[model samples]
Target chain A: MSTGGGEAEFEAALREAFERRGREAPAAAGLLEAVLARRRRQTRHRVAGAAVATALVAAGTLLGAQLLRGGEPAGPAAGVPAPGIFAAEEIELCLLPGGGDPAEVLLSAEVGGEEVQTAISEPAGDAFRLHVERAPGYTVRLDVLRGSVAGEPLDGARDVRAGDRPGRIGDAPGGGRVLLLETGTEGVLLRLTAEGTGPGDAELLAWAAKITVSTGRDACES
Target chain B: MEFDDYVLTRGDALLRFAHVLCNDAQRAEDLVQEALVRCHRRWRRIEHGGLDAYVRKAILRQYLSWRRRRSAEEGPAGDLPCAGGAPDQGIEAIGERDAMWRLLAGLPRRQRAVLVLRYYEDLPDAEIAGLLNCSAATVRVHAARGLARLRRHPELTGRAEVVEDA
Candidate 1:
């Protein structure tokens, strides 16, 4: 082929390749279903978030009024620990694609207070595990799962509250306590597992209160 | 048009366009899904006309700004399967086409996008610039650079020389 002819042939090949690839695109089956499902989830989250915000505002207003009136503020209520007592660190975990089945750890830090030594974050299938070693034998493991609860049953799970977040506390199989808290992000939950006999409900609740989970707004944001 | 009807009718075409833009099946689906989700929210306002154009623009913008999770060392997935038979149907012709496809894959995202829009979509430079949110001059520059890179490949040039000798 002449040079001009060769160039023309190359262009034709490129165009033809694009056309073929376009034809080879897979059927967009379940696309509408997926979009609708996502929209529903987002709507649910927005409603729940609005409710929580309204409740917080009301409670804050009541407490402020009492304090301004010179009335003694109520002591720490049982089960509901005082907020901001523990130095909480917000850890942002970026969820992987495909429903974030296997999330990537964007950040990790010392959770709870100085009593907790260090936090080790690892990507577990369908869950992001954050291991906090309180002492030699006492380790607190928190697994963040996106979009669903862990395999543990919620039948006998007790309702627990950490700050404004509501969750369920249950006994983990194989001898441990598990606290599942709903991370503010839609469909993301933090499964706090207390392995070893060292920490009980009090310690677990404290740790849960101190640690905050945030879905990072970068990689999967779009 | 109703959202469901629109999706059922044009969803396949959007998927194909996204596939051409991103060159990855999974990523293409994601791009289309995201664009549809955004459009679904405002379908009431845009349903009368230009809805297809709106969704296509959304897909293109997302593809351009997408931060790939994979490490930089990894390249895009391999090229799509062979389209069909070429005119010459010779070994050299096949080699050149394959080499050109790989070179196209390696171009910078913007340049690749420019070439795809100009050639595959048969868009003018101004239209492509409007989609890409850049000036027509910039679109021309990207297309020129991309075509120049493809033309300079040794495999294409050498294979052309071989075909000429024959």
Candidate 2:
């Protein structure tokens, strides 16, 4: 083996290989049509998912209204507080209960007459976690954890429970207010917590009562 | 240009580029197809003169990100091709080409990519850097190390003439 012709040989060999491969490469053929078809299907799926999420949100709102009917609601006193609303933005592909994309959900509401901007959450296991900045060095968060099963369904309390069953607005560890809501869906739970000069127990409960689900359907769903 | 036009002109070249990077036709096809799908999705957002570079970058990224699927059931360390051998004199051009492919495959993924982009794509360091999302200095480092590894390959050991060192 000599080093003398190695460079020439390597370059020549690469060129030859490229030419040979070009001769065997497939034509564009049906590729364009296939891509277009995929895009169309994704659009349809997104539209359908959004519709489903909207229906769920409406049902959940009804349930929240019913739950609040029995309790003595607190007045907003000096300022009107915003409801805790968890709205799904874009659902990621293959992360939903029905084998669709995971929804990009957010939590937003007004606190004390000021409109708090929206905030997105980080995905954690079967939950989406959101942290909202209330003031300098003070914050609050909402964790929406989901669970579902197919075929051997768990009745209304299991797979298909709507998103509005009320539990209790109680003390959470670390001095935060926690509202546990059994979402109308069987396996979904919305845990809303407010800490440091954030929403109070009554406000958090009201927010939980007004939780909404909006779907941002993913355009890349398979 | 329209997305379809871009695909018609650049699809085969992207496939060939993938083949060189992965050294397997099926894997190359899959990588190129995945990249094309992604490019199609973001077609409107991509700038002019950017699609080819974007697709190339996507293919390389997919190739590098693929998980190694070699099973434990396969033969262990002894299964690797020999690292030390003089380039066989009796072998024809096709054999030499294969020899080169083997040597190229032996390098680490990034080094192999740098060498292929440099020699096969004939891309300049700055451009290759842009495609790889790395600095030009890093590209040079990869190219230098890759060429050094090729020079040290056992197959090229006895070759009277070696390619110029990077």
Candidate 3:
């Protein structure tokens, strides 16, 4: 696939495509910055905590506990410039159980206004096949990790199941695990593995979710 | 990644990819911007793994899916006029590239995905198979069909479509 003429032509095509985009990339910074600002909630939360602790420490030695408080789990001051990304921590998910085969529910994330849906399959023993892709219709930025389902409903999803929260995930036909969590505003579908029984199926979900995109150094340390 | 850091890093590539996918320069910028914001809110996890890969796939899928549904329900995209054949130049022009874009748009999501992964990202069939939900056989099929469709475009000529020669 790398003959001389072929390589030249390919280079030309790629070059043309790149040039065409060069004209439009200028405004992208503003848009990306705005989006990141929204996610900066975590950073804001941390800074705020530090500010509060500092003020308290000044107020009295009673709260000087701030000095020895581990200082918000320090990391390198900032990210290196070239990686084109910085990150905080991976999403941490806590499972609530519902009973049945857990194959039905999956975890989801969105990227670039697109939906990235993920489901864990028990195609065999102990090993899980991850199904990740974009879904149609509503757009999302899926930052997904680990997934499971339980035999019965999870306490949070079940207790709050009736009110403002609508159930986006349902048990699979012939019944399935049905544990769902509304983490903040994001939704997660948990299911059981192959021969899957009720909700709260696997332990992998917690570990996987935390292994988010390799953008943030802070998240990596955790 | 932190919101600021995400912008710092991915702004350019995501912007470029989104531009190609959406056609409208401004809209691509908007879509990428919006996506990143959402990603940031969920940055804890989204920034991990093959983040670039995940982000690229997500953007294209969202762009294509939205385009598909919009075409079905709305009058027209207005900005996205149906892209059609133009002569192949010795060096690809902006217009010729746009024509290739249209051809890519014609492919099924999986086929398009295979071509993008195999040809663009240069991911192997196994990896492409993992990316899209199908067997390696399915990846091969998609690649074959995707190439065939590209070949059918009159502008592609003997140059673009010759796989072995490529």
Q: Give i-RMS (Å) per prediction.
A: 7.9, 12.3, 10.7
lDDT of 3 by residue, B1-166 (tens): 5556656776676766665445455466556654555455556767476677666655655554422323321111123221222334455454566666676677776676566566545679997777665799989998887766766667654335443253
Number of the predicted model whose DockQ against the real structure is largest: 1
- Candidate 3 docking class: incorrect
Off by over 4 Å in 2: A1-24, A41-222, B66-94, B156-166
Judge candidate 2 against the unseen true structure and give its global Cα lDDT, from 0 to 1. Answer: 0.55
Taking chain B only, the TM-score of every model is 0.75, 0.78, 0.65
Fnat: each model in turn: 0.33, 0.19, 0.19
Give residue A184's lDDT in candidate 3 (0 to 100): 27
Which portions of model 3 miss their true places by more than 4 Å?
A: A1-27, A36-222, B46-49, B64-68, B71-95, B158-166
Question: Which is better, 1 or 3, measured by DockQ?
Answer: 1
What is the DockQ of the complex in model 2? 0.13
DockQ for each numbered candidate: 0.17, 0.13, 0.15
C-alpha RMSD in Å of predicted model 2 compared with the true structure: 12.7
Can you write out model 1's per-residue Cα lDDT over A19-118, one digit (the tens) per residue? 7668767576666776676567656865785576445444543533343223654323212322222223333334443454443543333223111222
Give the Cα RMSD of candidate 3. Answer: 15.1
